[model samples]
Target: MISVYHYMTIAAILFAMGTYGVLTRKNAIVIFMCIELMLNSVNLTFIALSRHLNNMDGQIFVFFVMTVAAAEAAVGLALMISFFRNRESIDVEEIDLLKW
Candidate 1:
């Protein structure tokens, strides 16, 4: 039986890696992937807690989060496509054009 602590540790590591990728990567796509990783880490934690507590609420919340993530990914990818068509590059720094 996997312990909750183990699940939490793995989640923490994954979230940390995602955070690092978001902070240090210059590519917009990579940052998006990192954000997905972070979301997945949270999902893992949710599922683990749901099982440990013998409750369906955490699992239900995870389902909602996944749904939102899918929607966000769709919209985000559409925006990325538009940005790429206009700029010809997916570098995060290049997006400074929107900076005030």
Candidate 2:
């Protein structure tokens, strides 16, 4: 039977993959997606633990996390779009819009 440990393991693996993508990818969108993946993994963990403990706290926290993630995605996409418009590319290495 599947247990909280299984879910936790899967979440950990997904978080690791997301971390790797964030560290190694140069594309702004890919990095953004990786960040989302990491957030999802955390949500999974919260849900799993909440179920295991028969409590509502972790599940409630997941709702807050999701809300923040949605807001972040909107703002992040807007920033990326603006950056792309200004630079004509979303490469992280070329992001110097804030440079003097």
Candidate 3:
């Protein structure tokens, strides 16, 4: 019988992987993907807890979080595209948008 604990554990593993990828990856796109992964893990947690508690609050919060994540992905992708156009590379270490 699967339970909330199982879901929570899976989410925790996913979050950890995302965190590690974000910390170690140098590519902006990869980092963005990792961020998305982390967000998804949080969503999983929220859904699990919402079901466990038989409440709507966690689900409601997940809805808002998804909305924000969508907006962030759009803006982040746009910025990455613009940066790539300017520098011809998306390496995090090479980004110097503020400098001439």
> For all the candidates, what are their Cα RMSDs to the real structure?
1.1, 1.6, 2.0
Residue range 1-100, candidate 1, lDDT tens digits: 7799999999999999999999999999899999999999999999999999999999999999999999999999999999999999999899885666
Give the per-residue lDDT of model 2 (tens digit) for 1-93: 999999999999999999999999999999999999999999999999999999999999999999999999999999999988988999999
Question: What ranking of all candidate models by lDDT puts the best one first?
Answer: 3, 2, 1
Write candidate 3's Cα lDDT for 1-100 as tens digits: 9999999999999999999999999999999999999999999999999999999999999999999999999999999999999989999999655677
lDDT of each: 0.95, 0.97, 0.97
| Higher-TM-score candidate of 1 and 3 | 1
- What candidate 2 gets wrong by more than 4 Å, as runs, is 96-100
Task: Record all residue pairs in model 2 with backbone atoms less than 3 Å apart, i.e. clashing.
Answer: none
Q: State the TM-score for model 1.
A: 0.95
TM-scores, one per candidate: 0.95, 0.94, 0.93
